[model samples]
Structures are given as C-alpha cells and as structure tokens.
Target: MTVEVFALGGYGEAGGRNMTAVRVDEEIVIFDCGMSLDKILIFEKDFQKATTRELRKVNAIPDDSPLKPHRSKVVAAVLSHGHLDHIGAASKILFRYQCNIFGTDFTVELVKSDLKGEERYRSETEDIKISMYAVEPGDEVQISSKLRLEFIPISHSIPGTVLPVLHTPYGAIVYACDFKFDDHQLLGYKPDYKRLKELGKEGVLLLIPESLRVKEEMKTPSEAVAREMVKDTLQFAEEESEGIIVTTFSSHIERIQTIADTAERLGRNVMLVGRSMGKYARIAEELGLLNLPPGSRVYDKPETVARGLHRANKEKEDWLLIVTGHQGEPGAVLPRIADDELPYKLTENDSIVFSSSTIPSPLNKAQMYSLDTKLRMKGVKMFKDVHVSGHAGREDHRLLLRMLQPEYILPAHGDADMLSAYAEFASQEGYEINKDVFVTFEGTKVTIPL
Candidate 1:
C-alpha cells in the first residue's frame, strides 16, 4: 500500500491559507481549506464576482488545481479547527467535489455560517452539494475500506481544536496543524499524547506538523498564563483607571471566560461588543462550552452597541468592555468607537488592554498604529502583547517529533525560511533531508516511501 501527499496550500507564508491532502490508492482526504486574507482583500467587496480560478491566481484560496484530477475520488474534507485560516475556503471550494465535510461541533457551525453568507455562490453551484458531520475528539471517521480518521483534541486559542490522524493500510498519517501542547489548557482537554503515542507505536508513516513557531527556542506557555495576564491587567485597571476596555481574538472563548470571571471578581460588569464575539459566543453557548456569568451583556448589532455604551456613559459606570479589532480591521467595533461613531467615549486614564498580537505585516502594523494614535489622542491608557502564542515552539516541536517518531517528516503551514529551520532541527534528530525529511511548498506532491 502507498499514499501520495499534496501540499495544497499554506506553504510559503504566515497568516495564509492551510490545505493539505493525502491519497491512499483510490481514496483521498483533504486536511484543511483556508484562504489568504491578504489575497482576498483585493477582491473583498465583490467576492461573488471573483471566480475560483481567479482566487487561485492571486493565491487567495488553496491551489486546488492539483485535486481537480481526482475530484470525484475525494472521500471527505476535514477541518482541524474553526479558525478562519483553517476552515475559510471549505464552504466555497469543497462542495465542488461533492464530498462530506467533517469537523468538531463549533467548526461545523462555522462552516455552515460561511456557506449561509455565500448564498449566491451556493446558488450558482446548483448541482454541487455537501454535508457537514460533527465529530468529537475521539470519534473515528471511516472514509473507505482502506482509510479511517481520528480527531485528537488539541489546545489552541479556540475551544474545539483537534489534531487529525488518518489510519490506512499503509500506515497512520498525522496532521498536527495549528496546535500547542498545553497539558493544563483552560479551554478543552489536554493534547491526547497517550493516544498519539499509541498510534505512534502502531507505526506512523508520514507526519505533517505545522512549523509556524519552530524557530522559538522553548516550549510555548500554557493558556493559563494568558488568563493570568488578562486577570492581572483587569485588576490593575479596576483600581488604577477610570474604565477598562480590552480586545482579543473573538473566537478565544477561554480568554473570554477568564475575562468574565475576573471582571466579576473585580465587581465590574462585562459587555461584549463585536459581531464576531457574538457569533462565537452563541456557537460556544450552543455547545455548552461557554460559562459566562448570568447578566453578562453581549451587543452584536451596531445600534445595540451604541445604545449600551450610551447607557454606560450616562450612568458613569465602570465596566469591562471586550471588543474585537486587535489587528485594527477597518470596520471592526474598536475602530468605530475610536472614530467616535459609537456612543462610547474615551477619557483620561481609561485602560485598553490588547490581549492579542499583530500579524507583523505592514498593512496590519499601519492600521494598528492608526488606532493607537486615535486612542492616545483621547488619553486612553494602553497595554499590549499580554498573550501567549498557540503554535508549538522549537522545544515542543522536538518533543512531538520524539513522541511520534515517524519514518518521514513534512513541515507545513510555514514559508521556506521557517521550513528550513525545521529541516535543520530534523537533521539534528538524525533524519536526513530529502530522504527522511521532506520540505515542500504549495502544489508539490510527494509519494511516501518506507
């Protein structure tokens, strides 16, 4: 038995789309279908007008041209998590192959919401259809007589992230994308290392791990550290400032949970004011994962936000306001408030804690600085980078390699430079490049040799 591996997308950049495929003889499974936000921004206003081929040309979506030849042979499309860069392109692209979609509960809802937003796109593809299946951490998906899939729960910024493992007659293929090994994760269960080692003992033929932060020298901090950071900042602002406004990833329910618990302890009311926060909050609530205190307010609509802020302003109430726009997106809630479009007013000594990191692009940096200027002009106090990354750093990557002990190594979700660092690390661990360690990019395909 043999398996062919394809680096469909997410090869040469950061904050880009991540898609991978593994084919065992006649059956195939695609790992993820994310889109490049930078590429998509050029055609953002009229996404429906942009053809799939056009998106591919700009590298907005995965270069799925490689899979077109075996389109009908696709057995399933699986997403590792609900992050936009992991599941963004699935609703638009996977349906073209008429395959079943698999994800965790939150991720399934994310795909459904994406599809619902693309009504015109779905309408045009009248003959194409897809089904979404919700699979838990330990659930196994049987693709064909020769292939089986298992989702192993892993900790990330989001609540329902998983590491996918494919079991085939040839061997087990592990897709460890966008994860941090947090034994004390605040959101979900710890990394299933026992199960991972068990599968390793059964012989993992090919291991494709995300190398986004492999250059960092140590193991990544636990999510609990971020929670403490948030708590400390909120406590400080409660005593030292007039009001507190914080921003973080909307999908970070664990952070949100920490914020809510800490705000309650500090005797401040919690108000969530962002469309994305509302969407993810509702998704987590439905899955019984959100544990917000009763009476915590969520304002999704612009009018509702303005009204709530107006009331807070009128009462001179000191509340903890959680918002989106950590990257300073143009139309996000934080920018609107900074522009005075919202009813909220910034005043002296009011703290703004940034619990997120910028993607380090010129465009993102420019926007963030613009927002910073606006807030500073109003005398708003600022706190930044009070966060921990969700990717495996160099030490964690080394440990994972030791635990899995696969025959070959393939690094995904990073550019050539990052992959080069990872390749060197693999060599130090005794795997020779091009023979046991494969460093590939988008559109490159490899046939696994044992």
Candidate 2:
C-alpha cells in the first residue's frame, strides 16, 4: 500500500485556513477545511455572499484545485472541531466532492447552521446541500473498503473537539491539530489517555500534529486556570470600575461560562452581544453543553443589541457585557464600541477585559495595537491576556510523542518558523529532520510507501 498527503493550506501559516487531503492507495479523506480570519478581516467581504473563487483570490480559503484529479477518490470530509478556522469554509467548499461530512455533535450542528445561512443567501439554482453525520467519541466509521475513521475526544478552546484517526492498511494516521492534554476542563471531556496509549501500541504509521505552541517549552495550563484568571480579573475590576466589557472567542463556551458566572458573582447581570457570540452560545446552550444563568440575555440582531447596550449604559455597574472582536477586527462589537458607533459609550476607568491573546498574525497585531491605542485614549482600564491558550505546548508535545510513538511525523498548522521549530524539537527527541520528521507547506504533496 502507498500513502500520500496533500497539504492544501494552513501548513505554512500560523492563523488558520487549514485543509489537508490524505490518500491511502486509491481512496482519500480530507481534514479541517478552515479559513484565514486575517484575510477575511483585511478584505472585509461578507462570506455568505462571496463566491469560492473570490475567497480564493484573497487567500481567505484553501485552494483545493490540487484535488481535482483525485476528487472522485475522496470519500469523506472530517472536522476536528467547530471553530470557524476549522470548519468555516464548509459552505464555500465541500460541494465538489459531495462526500459525507463527519464531526462530533457540536461541530455538525455548527456546520448545519452555516449551511442554512448559506442557503438563505444563495439563489434557488445553487445546490449547497450535503450529507453530514454526527459521530461521537470512540465511534468508528468505515468510509470505504480500504479506509476507516475514528474519533478520540480531546479538550480545546471549543467544545466537541476530537483527534480524528484514519485507519488504513499501512497503519493509523493520527491528526492531532489544536488539542491540549488537559484534565481539569470544567465543561469538556478529559483527554482519553488510555485510548491514546492503546493507539500507540496498535502502531501509528504517521502523525500529523499542530505545531503552533511547540516552542513555548512548557505544558499548556488547564481551562480551570483560565477560569480563575477571569474570576480574579472581574472581581478586581468590579471594585475599581463602573462599566465592564469583556471579549473572547465566541466559540470558547467554557471561557464564556466562566465570565458569565464571575459577573453574576460580582452582582452584575450578563449580556452577550454580537452575531457570532450569540450564535455559538445559543447553540451550546441548546445542546446542553452550556447552561447560561437565569435572566442572562443574548443579543444578536441589530435592534436587540442596541436595546441591550442602552440598558447596560443606563446601569453600567449592574451589567457585564460580553462581546466579539477580541482581535480588534473592524466592525466587530468591541471595535464599534471603541469607535462610538454603538449605543454604549466608554468612559474613564471603564473596564475592557480581553480574555484572549492576539492571534500572532501581522494583521491581528496591527489591529490590536490600534484598538489598544483607541481604548487608552478614551482613558479606559484594559486587562489584556487575562486568558490561557488552548493549544498544547512543548512539554505536552513531548508527552504526546511518548504516548503515540508514530513512525513518521509531519508538523502542521503553523508558519514556516513554527513548523521548523517543531522539526527541531523532534530532532531532540531522536527523530531525524528530512528523514522521518517532515515539514511541508501549502499545496505540497509527500508520498510514503508501506
């Protein structure tokens, strides 16, 4: 048997837009069709109305043209999580192959929601419908006679994230993108250590792991730690400020829950604002993954958001506003607030807490600098990086390497420097660069024989 890997996107960049195609003999499977948020922000195009070609022109989505010849061989599209960077391009792509889509429950629901929005915007002549299956952890799906897929539960910034395993005649290929080995997450499954060790014993032929934080030289902190950070920051800000506004990844339901609960403890009601923020939070609440406190409100529509902001403005000390645009993307809720385009106004000593870090992309860095400058000029108190990361660090990578002793390694999901860092770290672990440890970029294909 022979195996070939096509790094469609996200192999050479830090911020997402990740797509990869794996072929086991004649059959193939794809993983994580994500989008580049930095590109999307820079272009400021409405994704629902934008065509696939337009998105490709701006590098917002992965260029899947490399799969043209092998399109017929593609059997399935598996999503690791529901993050837009992981599943954002679902409607833009996934129609050509018309293959079955597989993800965990939350991921599947999020994709369905995206497809519904796409359908609303498209003409009747367009056909965007595709079959999607929600698979749970430990469920193994036989894609074809030659290929099988398995889901192993893991923790991340978002809920329902998994390590997708592709089993073939050669061995199992483990996709370990965007995962943290944390056991103290309050709202998600703990890492399935026993199963990972078993997979190690069963023999992993190739391991494709995310290399974003491999250079940190420490284990990633648990979500529980982030909870404490949020609680501590909110409690301190409550005593010093009259208004509190917080921003984070909308998909990070755990962090949102922490913030909401902390706000309640501080005698402030929670008001979740913005479209994406309300969408992800409501979905998680519907799926029983999140139980929002009673009387807490989510405002997505423009009219509702205006009304909510007006109420918060009247009683600034009594309400805590959770919003989008933690990266300072233009037109997002927080930035609009800074620009005075919204009903609410920022004043001296008002708390603006960022429960997220800058994404480390050039566009993100610049936008954040501008946002910080604007907030500081308004004399607001800003609490930055009041959060921990969801990605694994150097020590966590070491533990994963020891648990799943794969014969081959492909460092993915980062820029050139990040990928090279992973390769160097692997060398210290006794793997040879250019031998078993491979570093590849977008559109590059590598083949291995078994």
Candidate 2's residue-wise lDDT over 182-249, tens digit each?
A: 89998777899999999999999999999999999899999988988999899989988999999999
- In terms of lDDT, the poorest run of 10 residues in model 1 is 41-50
TM-score to native of every candidate shown: 0.95, 0.98
- Candidate 1 lDDT over residue span 153-232, tens digit each: 88888878998889888788889888888988767758888888888788988889888899999999998888889888
RMSD to truth, every model: 1.9, 1.1
Candidate 1 local lDDT, residue 99:
85
The positional error of residue 128 in candidate 1, measured at the CA in angstroms, is 4.6
Candidate 2 regions with alpha-carbon error over 4 angstroms: none
Error of 1 at 30 (Å): 0.4
Error of 1 at 49 (Å): 7.9
Candidate 1: C-alpha RMSD after superposition: 1.9
TM-score of candidate 2 to 2 decimals: 0.98
